[model samples]
Target: MHMTAQDSRGSRASTIFIVDDDSGTQQLLADTLSYKGYATRCLSSGRLALTAAAEDPPDLILLDVMMPDMDGFEVCRLLKMDQATRFIPVVMVTSFNEKAMRLKGIAAGADDFISKPIDATEILLRTRNLLLVKQYNDFLKEHAGILEQQVRLRTEELEKVIAELRTTHQQLVQQEKMATIGQLTAGIAHEINNPIGFIASNVTSLGKYCERFLTFIKAQQTTLAACLPDPDQAERLQAMGNQLKLERIIDDVPNIIRETMEGVDRLKSIVMDLKCFSRVNDAEQSIADINQCLESTLNIAGNELKYKTIVKREYGELPPFSCHPQQLNQVFMNLLVNAAHAIDTKGEITVRSWSSNGWIHVSISDTGCGISEQHLSRIFEPFFTTKEPGRGTGLGLSISNEIVRNHGGRIEVESLVGQGSTFTVSIPMKSQGHG
Candidate 1:
């Protein structure tokens, strides 16, 4: 159906050029387009068409595949190659309905291909769509030039998008960390529970010990008052001590205090590790023990791995390297959590590290669902994920890649589709900005 006259009023009238050596076909196409209220020009030769196009370009060209001097492909190529008429949409017109001819036409810059003995309705639809596309492209070009004048506005828009993306990515990372923290709730409580529980028990026992000593003191005082020379209070005290097993209580009280102190120390260590993991020291690069970073990160991810896999650590002795410890901890946490998720019910995760040639190498390998070859290449691409919907935000590896690159590091991956995958990160021992 033709668009309303109102649609055509403000918009420029589109011109169609029918280029075909077949006089009958050309006339028919011209009449069909003319009936659609489109202006039409017919040319029987590619040479004439080229000349006319350069003189006055048409909005869309219907090109015949078989011509006398030049074929449709060559004519289309020459038309597209020219600067003046290249934007005009070329529709390949031919009776040859074959895949090869269609591909050839496409290769030669034909915007569309329509088989010959063209249906009036089909021609109208195809031509109309092509005209619309050309007009839209022209409109874009015009507005794009206007946009070039408003660079600051466009830049502000871009920055806003970038900021939003960064915020979203951070939220995703924090969400994963929070999930890990939830898993750690039980383990950390268990760690703290032991010490506090024992300390409470010890306090109760210490209170009973004090009461027994008080009773013995009262008995000694009564003896002192009753008679001659305090009536062997020392002997009575010794007998009372043996009866109450005071020696054992004295020895055990010291031991309980020591154990409680050790437990308190352990609790302090865990709290300190958690603090270090979350420290704002990430704002500056500093010398850090990579092994310690990994160990602390492993602790954070312990709950994720404990039930799912057996973790083996073949950590080489590491020299302190300049890095943002908190950021590296983030990287390690992401890797560890990913490894844990890769497993179905149970599997093995191996974390290995070493230093070579002034570089530190750390690897996390998992026997889980390995990435398919098709997806492996895009693993570090933002928003590309193989994980099921609502399962993960694909930004983990992407963020890891950014962090590694910022630290002057590179990551290498090896994976088999069903067997396993290994991601190795190698960073400079002395990263840039290290003083």
Candidate 2:
């Protein structure tokens, strides 16, 4: 028996091993495989083949069915059982026409069966197909690994994007809140100043009245001390009391002064409510009282509501919330003003708030000309307005919507034409920090 091992001629080309007892058969296979651009090796016996293959495996194996010392089936069986050589594809080549012989070869672990005398074309075609299939299988395995890696990387990127979006949203909400408060400051100051002006005037007048009364009383005391020697002292005292009008002035002045002072104090409370609503002194995120914000909004918007609407509040038991209080105050103000504008005649505005499921919900409802179905959907879209020109800037609802979204919340509106409208805002309890 003779043995030969040939390295693949083509760089990066696959190799084929041919084992046969007939020199002619070996020469024929070698020429055929080599002509087809595959590197080929020809061996005269199975023993020499085993030795050569164990030394350096080929990409594929073609074993002859008939051999003297050992048949092709036994060689194939041994090769299949070996862990190092099992991955190599083996095709049995034989002149045997019996079905049992082919089955025996397959049962011995041959990857495929080819009958001889082999057609050169058939040999080439089978080799090409098997090699191509093996290459594709390897590629699929490698590609799957790369695909898994890509999936992991893409998931991480998406998570980063979601986090960034959350952070940007919160910032926008805070900015809108500050803007609304800034706009309302002038109007609120004007409202508070009116009562303060009148109260100050009333206090000044009361001071003068007290001084006049004190002077008149001193006059009466001097006259009485001088005239006590005669009955005319009684006449003089009565005359002085008449001049001072001490009876009625003393009775009514203190009550008037007290009432005026109470009015001034009430005005001060309203101003305090405005301060709370705007949250000018609070931090970005702090414990906020929603009821206080609502009250301030009502006071700041009092002039807008006084003639056209009656305001009512239906407050629920709510816990103190940590939030951007100024922003929430802006939302309240927008809804209230919108409600006030909705009414053509006397109507009602209702503000309600409560907490549930780790969230705070505030609803402002108005009995005014309600929104049309067509308009409701577009209400939150930036620059959309149903108000007459110059009456609406078209940014209020849009800005409010943006603010709510930033706070990890949502705003919804319900309205009916000629009936009224309601705007509800919901915000999460905790800030979902920056992405």
- Residue 84 displacement (Å), model 1: 60
**How does each model score on TM-score?**
0.36, 0.36
> Model 1: how far is 319 from its true place, Å?
0.8
Q: Per-residue CA lDDT of candidate 1, range 335-388, in tens?
A: 898889989998999999999999999999999889888888878765567788
Q: Which ranges of candidate 2 are over 4 A from the true structure?
A: 1-283, 433-435
Error of 2 at 224 (Å): 63
Local accuracy by lDDT, each model = 0.80, 0.78
lDDT, candidate 2, 1-435, per-residue tens = 111222222345577889999999889899887775677888888898888888998888899988999999999999988877777788999888789998898899988878897898888778776776656655676789999999999999999999999989976876686567545854776677787987778797876888688778778777777768876767777788889887777777777777777768766655644554343334386788888988898899899999978888898887887777777777788788889898888999999988898888999999899999888877875447888865665657765675676678889888889888989998877745311
Kindly report which residue stretches of model 1 are placed more than 4 angstroms away from their true locations once superposed: 1-282, 433-435
Error of 2 at 195 (Å): 35
Q: Indicate the worst ten consecutive residues by lDDT in candidate 2.
A: 1-10
Worst 10 residues of 1 by lDDT: 1-10
What value of lDDT does candidate 1 attain over all alpha carbons? 0.80
